[model samples]
Target chain A: MQAIYEYLFGAASFVPHGYCLAWRPDLIAIHALSDGVIAVSYFSIPIALILLLNKREDLAFKRTFGLFALFIFACGVTHLTGMIMLWEPYYGAQGMIKLMTALISVITAISLWPMLPKVLALPGPSQLRAMNERLADEISDKNEAQIQLHNAYSQMEAQVVARTRELQEVNQRLKEDVQRRTLLEEELREKAELLTATNAELERFAYVASHDLQEPLRKIQAFSDLLKREYENDLPEEALQYVLIMQNAAHRMNKQTKDILTLSRLSWDSIKFASVDLAEVVEEVEFDLAERIEESGGKLEIGDLPLVPGDRTQIRLLMQNLLVNAFKYRAADSTPEVKVNATLHERGAPGTGGAYVELTIQDNGIGFNQEDAERIFSIFQRLHGRSEFDGTGIGLAICKKIVENHNGAIEAVSSRGEGAIFKIQLPTSQPTRRNNDAGRNEAI
Target chain B: MQGVTKRFKVLMVDDDPEDGVLVQKAIASAGHKVDFQVVTNGAEVLDYLFTEGRFTDQSRAPRPNLILLDLNMPGVDGFTVLKQIKSNMDLRRIPVVVLTTSEAETDIVKSYDIGANTFITKPTSFADMIEVMKSLKKYWFDSAQLPVA
Candidate 1:
């Protein structure tokens, strides 16, 4: 070891260290200052590098930065050794430091060659800024889409709320309408019941009044007739004439009361509907009017008549009234010719399948004026004086009542000095009682 | 008239005196040998038929051959009287006729339903009343046979 050291420091000293440099005090001071400054700067550089490494813990290639810092420190130490050689020949140490610096330099250079591509592949500042700008743009577009979706959701919610409110209002209106209709129906039912009661009461009053009225009138007629029968010779001519007038008035009043009673009793009780042969009714009526027909020289002809639904008694009365009217209204010169005919017809709308039997009684008699046709059906409505006709003028009215009771209709067609036709239409099948009751209520 | 040697005793039950008098006159005019006795009200007629109250004397209230009843009265109307008479064994043999001013069909049907022998509506005129009475006399006193009391 001593030999090797002697070889490095004895004659192999390339520049005889400090003597070859011609070292003056000024040069020595300058070199020492320069070396001191470089040494300090180098140490400071390493300290700064360590501090930076500590602060930037994420710094890339940390091993390479550490190696560069160690090399620079070795160079500053070599400079310090050069300054020491001017004073003492520590040539061996100086040589060793220089060699160490050369070795570090060579190692740093070789390590840098392999790290070149890695450093070049890293992103530069401009490239990183451009990528950040693109990310910001994408985030902005996503935010815009989210805002549009939120707005659409809010609009749909608002429409749903509005539709729900509108439906609630319509439902409220429908509820009110249903309530109003129910109230109206209740009122109508009450009114119908009241009207039915009133009609029954009126019918009862009519029946009672007619019946009571007939009682007193009968007494007057009976007593008056008794007086006339037993004491006619005792009375003066004028008094006898007065008695005759009284008798006539009483008889007329009695007839009127009886006719009123018949009219009132038409619908006084429940009707029993049955199928009646109209031909049989006509025959019975003809039998009842036989004497009158013979006296008036009236010729009666009957055609085909149908069996109709009606009350048997009421139909007989209706036929009697019509026949009596025919016989009573005969012409003064011509023989009364009466013809009765019937036909079946469809009633109401065509497809309804409702049918009726129409009976037409045509007469060759002293027909009334057409204007009085409607008036003739009114009770006690006389067209001629008592001298011209001996009737209470209630026969047609009774006929009309009977026809209405059977759910039938009667119409008269006549002209002055012409024949009259009484057309009667009766339903073949009885309408329901409810329909008849409704019709009666309307008439009342 | 067969089996009518004695005059027919008729009891007329009425509410109105004028109606009762008129019925008597109509019967007389019908040429019937009838002795008519009038009771003013339906209750009095019942009393006479049962021989009770004011009609306790059997000789004065003899059994009538025919009883003419009026339906509408102040008390115990003709329907009740007829019911009572037909239910009693002693009075049921007498023929009861309903002679009323009521022309209502219900009255006629009810009278016949309660064992009335005949039903007749009182005519409004004296002539018509006489005719009806004549028919009644012909049917009851002349044609119809009566049970011996």
Candidate 2:
């Protein structure tokens, strides 16, 4: 232990560089400053490497950086020894430090020789910069994608708002339409009720008026007749003439009132529709007008008549009126001839389908002017004065009303000094709804 | 008024006095020995028939062989009177003829439905009325057999 200690501490064994040369302070200071500066630089470099290694934990080739740090520390220690030798002549210490330095340099050199390829393979600063640029571009692309996704979400939200508004508008319009339809239906119902009430009132008025009017007219006729019969011998010639006129007027008025009542009764009266044989109606008319026909010496000719849908009583009345008119208007020279015939008329275009029965009552009598043919159907319308024709002028009007009630039409063709033809068209089937309403209004 | 042989009694029901008078004159002119009694309205006719109210005395209110009913009356119409008379077993035997100014088919139909014996419109002229009365007398008094009073 004494010998080892003597060998390690023996500081006078070697000469110092400063003892062999002139003691130049400036050179020594310069050398010492350089050694100190080199030592400090080496020491600082190793500390920086340690800190860099700690911070860059993910850096590759970590062991290589550790080896480099050790080598730099050894170099810093050798420089520190050189700075000490510059002050004191410690040649043994210097030689020892140099020997350690040489040993560390050899280890470092050998270690570096094997790691040359690894060091070359390691990415350079420029390559790392290029990779970092790519990483930054990827990050930017991801950010752009996130922004676009946000924009799409916002646009979708806006579209949803617009769609919601449109749906709300459609729903509003549907609600309005429903309200309008309900209102219109209610209005139509109210109008229909009002029309029905009016029709009923009018019917009642017609019935009462016609019924009450007959009573007074009957009394007038009765009392006038009583006056004429009770005062026949007491009255003078002129007074008797006046009485005759009064009687004639009263009789005409009574006939007119009766005719008016019959017309008014047609409005409220309900008639049963049945299959009426025209031949039967004609036979009844002939029987009813037998007296008139015999007085006029008229010959009645009957032909084949079809069965038609109509009211039996109305048709009988219709035939009676036409036949009576024929006998009443006979010529003074010729005997009256009345012919009744019926033919089937196809309605609408030829061969189309529906048919109606047409009854033609031709008369060889003193026919009126052709202009008066249509005018004869109007109530109380007469072409001749009461003196010329003895009638209430309501017979043809009644005939017209009866035909209309059966949903039929009556037309006359006549010329002065010539015969007259009364053509009546009757439906083969029951009247259609429109025709039925028209017939009802015509009754009113 | 003591009768030789009780003539055919007729109770004429009418609202108008003039019509009643005319009908009486017509029956008299027709030369029929009809014991015509005039009642002002349907109520009076009912009183005369059932011997009630003013006609409670049996002698004055004789059982009518025939009733001539007017349709349009103030208190009780002819249709109701006809229905009431026909429904009553005692009064239904008396033939009730409808004599009115109404020639409406409804009036005739309703009168017949209520058991009216016959329906006739009162003629406007006196001569026509006389003729109708003659026919009525011939058919009701001369031809028809009445129930025992």
Error of 2 at B22 (Å): 0.9
**Positional deviation of B149 in candidate 1, in angstroms?**
2.3
**What local lDDT score does residue B132 receive in model 2, on the 0 to 100 scale?**
92
> In candidate 2, what are the lDDT values of residues B30-115, reduced to their tens digit?
98777888888888888888889998999999888888999988979888889889999989988989998777777888888889
lDDT of 2 at B13: 90
Poorest 10 consecutive residues by lDDT, candidate 1 chain A: A435-444
Q: CAPRI verdict on model 1?
A: medium
Q: Model 2, residue B108: displacement in angstroms? A: 2.4
Interface RMSD of each: 1.3, 0.7
Backbone atom clashes (below 3 Å) for every candidate: 0, 0
Residue-by-residue lDDT tens digits, candidate 1, A170-228 = 89999999899899889998888888778767766877787778877887887888888
How close to the true structure is residue B79 of candidate 1, measured as C-alpha lDDT? Answer: 94
TM-score of chain B of 1: 0.95
